[model samples]
Target: MIYKAEKFGEKYTTRWDNIDVDEILSSERLLGNYKKCLMDQGPCTPDGKELKKNLPDALKNDCSKCSEKQKINMHKVIDFFKDNKTEWWAELQKKYDPEGIYLKNHIANNRHGDKNDDKRDDDKKKEERDEMEKNDNKENSR
Candidate 1:
C-alpha cells in the first residue's frame, strides 16, 4: 500500500490521514532530491554511470514547508505509479510498509535483475565460441 511520508517519520512514526503523502512525494524539489540520491537520471546513459552516492538529505527542501498545491499534486502521481508499476517510491522507499503489505514489481527491484540478464548474451557468445572451437578441432582430427 502507498504511504504518507509522515507515516514513516518525516516527523514521527504515526499513521496520519490528514496529511497527504502523495503531495510530499510529488514535490519537484523532493523528487529531484530523490533523483539525485537514487541517480535515476534515465533508463540508460551513454556511459551508464550512477549519480553521486548519498546526496545529503539536508540538501533537499524541508517537507514541512511544502504548500498545499504541492501536496495535492502528489495524489494522482502516487496512484498513477502504483497502477502502472514502473514508477516508484523514491521518497517512501525507506519510509514504511506495514506487515503483510501487498507489493508490486517496480523499477528499482527489477533493475538489479536486468544487470544479470545483460551478461546472458556474453555468456551465450562465449559458449558458442567454445562449441565452435571444439567442433573445429574434432573436424581437423577426423
Candidate 2:
C-alpha cells in the first residue's frame, strides 16, 4: 500500500522522506509485507499502522495533506503498481476504492490510460439515475 503522508500537526514528519522507494518496490518480500499489513492479513510495523490509519483520509481528500515530495512518491508507487503489478493494484483498489470514486478521478487525470474507463463511469451514472427515477415513480404511485 502506498503511504500518502499525512499531516501530523502542520505537515507529516520528514522521517520517511529519504526512504528509497525503488529499493522497497524491487524487494518482493518488503512489498508483500506492506500489502499484508495494509490488508490486515498480517502484523503491521509501526509505520504501516500509521499509514493504515491515514489512508482513508488521504484517499477521500485526494492527499490534500500530503507534502509535494510525498505526493511525488505516492504517484511513483501508484504507477509502479499499475504498470508492473496490475493484479495487486486491482486488489488495493477493491479494498480502498470500493465505490470507484477514486478510480474515476485517476482515469479522469489520465493516470490509467484505459480508453473505456469513461464509458464505464457513464454507464454507472446512468444506472444510478434510472434507479432514482424508478424510486420516484413508485413514490408517486403510492
Candidate 3:
C-alpha cells in the first residue's frame, strides 16, 4: 500500500508492502547507534555559483530567483547533515521506519499559508534559528 506523510508543506510517500523489512530494521538500528553524531553537526557554507545538478531543468531554471530565506534554509539543512553525517543518517532511518512514523495532515492543511500567517511565521522562526545556529558554529570554529 502507498502511504504518505506530510510535514511543513512537503509530502513524503512510501510503499508499505513493497519495501524490505530487513532494510528498515537495519536502518533503525544504525540510527540508534549514531544519534550522538547527528546532534553535534554544524551548518553548511554558502555557495552562490548556481547549481545545474540533481534537479530537473524545470526546477533549476530559476534557482537564483528563490528567496533569501529559502536559500539559507537549504544551506543550513545541508550543513547540518554534512557536519553530522552519521547522526543525520540515523535520523533519516528513524524518519523512514514504518512502525514509529506518523502520517502528516497534508490534505487538511494547505502549503500556501493562505489560511493563516502563523505557519509562515513559524517557518520564518525555524529558518532564523537554523541561521543563528550556523553562525554560532562558525564563531566557535574561529
Candidate 4:
C-alpha cells in the first residue's frame, strides 16, 4: 500500500504487507517526535528540509524538550531504517504479527515484541470505537 500524507493531519497510511515492519515501527516512533514538532512549534514535513529551515529555533530549544529530542532522534531513526531495511524487516516480522487483521493491527504492527499486550488492549479500544461509529451512523441514518 502507498503511504499517503494527509493535508492538515500528520498521519499517513501504507500497505501492511508492503511495509517493512521494522522500518514502519521505527518510523512510528519517530512520528511521535514529529508530532511534537508540530504541536509545540508548528507544522513540519518529515522530509527534514522544512524543519531545518523554518524551525531552527524550535529545533534547538533544548535537549530536555521532547520535541527537540524528537527532531534529532527522528533523523537517526529514519536514517537507520533506510540503511538497514532488510535487518529491520526481519526483526519486525519475528516480533510482530504481520497478518494482524484487527484494530490493534495499526499500533501492533509498529511496536516491538514486549508491546503485544498493549497492542491487544489497543485493539479492544479500536473495536469499541468502531462499534460506536457504526451505531452513530445508524442513528444518523434513522
Candidate 5:
C-alpha cells in the first residue's frame, strides 16, 4: 500500500481506488471506524490516514485531482453517509465545511437522483439563515 503523496503527479495515486466502498458503506463497524478515523476520534489505519489527509483538498477542489474511478467511489461513499448517517455526515461537514463554502457544490453534485434531497437542502438553508438572522438581531440589540 503505497500511500505516500510523493509518487503523485498531476493527480493522486490510484493505489487505493479499488477499495470496496460498498462494503464499507453497508457495514456499520467499518463505517464507524472510517468516521472515527476521519473525525480524529480514533486511530487511523494507514489507508484511513491517507484518506483523512487528502479529504480536505478533495472537498475543496471537488475531487479535481481524483481519477474518474476515484470520483465515482467518492460520490458513493459521500451519498451513503449523507443519506444513512446524518449525524456523522454533519460532523464531517462541520470540520470540512465550517463556513459552508463548498456545501452547495456538494449537495448539487451528490443528489443521487433524489428529488427530495433538494427540498431537504433548501430547508436546511432556510434554517441556517434564520439562525444567522437571530444571532444578528441579538448582536444589534447589545
Candidate 6:
C-alpha cells in the first residue's frame, strides 16, 4: 500500500520539499510509528497504542478506511515546510550555503539580495587591494 500525500490532501502550490524524506509507508505499523514522532500528547491514534509499543494486529492491519486521518497527516507535512522557499528561508540559505546562488533567482522581489551580494564581493576585493598597497608603501618607506 503506497501512502501518498496526494491520495488524501489538497495539492500544494509547490511540490513537497523532499530534501531527505519522501513517501510514508502505508503499512499500518510503520505509519503508527511516524505519527508518534509528530504528535505532542497521547498516542498517535485514538486507540492509545503503537506510540509506546507496536499496534495490535487489529489496528495495524490496514488503512483502507483511513482517508481522513491520512489527510490530516499530509496537511501537517505541508505545514512542516511552511518556512521553506520563503523569504526567511532564503535569507538563512544565502548565509549558510556555499555555492548555490538560488535566493535571487528563485525568490520573488529579491533584488536586494543580489545587490548586497555584489556590493560585498566588490568591497572584499577593494579591501584586499588596499592592504596590498599599504604593504608596498611600508616597504618603500623602509
Q: Could you estimate the TM-score for every candidate?
A: 0.25, 0.68, 0.21, 0.22, 0.73, 0.30
Query: How far in Å is the alpha carbon of 15 misplaced in model 1?
Result: 12
RMSD of each: 14.2, 10.4, 17.5, 18.1, 8.5, 15.5
TM match of model 3 to true structure: 0.21
Q: Global CA lDDT of candidate 3, please?
A: 0.36
Model 2 weakest lDDT span, ten residues long: 1-10
Count of clashing pairs, candidate 1: 3
Q: Candidate 1 clashing pairs? A: 22-74, 23-71, 23-74
Output the better candidate (2/6) by lDDT: 2
Provide the overall lDDT of each model, using Cα atoms, as 2-decimal numbers.
0.39, 0.74, 0.36, 0.41, 0.78, 0.38
Query: What would the per-residue lDDT of candidate 2 be over residues 1-142, giving only the tens digit for each residue?
Result: 3353434555555567777888989999999988898888999898788778877776777666767776667766777786688898898889988897766665565544454555667889999999999999999999
TM-score of model number 5: 0.73
Model 2 Cα displacement at 83 (Å)?
A: 1.5
- The residue-level lDDT of candidate 4 at 132 comes to 100
lDDT of 5 by residue, 48-127 (tens): 88888888888788877788888888777767777788898899989987887666676677656245586778999999
* lDDT per residue (tens digit) for residues 9-105 in model 1: 3532123335454564557665445444444543422111211221122113222322344323333344444444333553333333222131222
Candidate 3 residues 76-132, lDDT tens each?
Answer: 333344334645635543544324222122112323323334655788899999999
Clashes of 5: 0
Compare the candidates by lDDT and give the number of the best one: 5
lDDT of 5 at 101: 62
Residue 75 lDDT (model 2): 68
How do the residues 1-142 of candidate 4 rate in per-residue lDDT, one tens digit apiece?
A: 1123245434322222233434545575564444344344445554433443333232233212223334334334434443455455344333332442322332333344226446667999999999999999999999
Comparing 3 and 4 by TM-score, which wins? 4
Ten residues in sequence with the least summed lDDT for candidate 3:
45-54
lDDT of 2: 0.74
User: Deviation in angstroms for 18 in model 2?
Assistant: 1.3
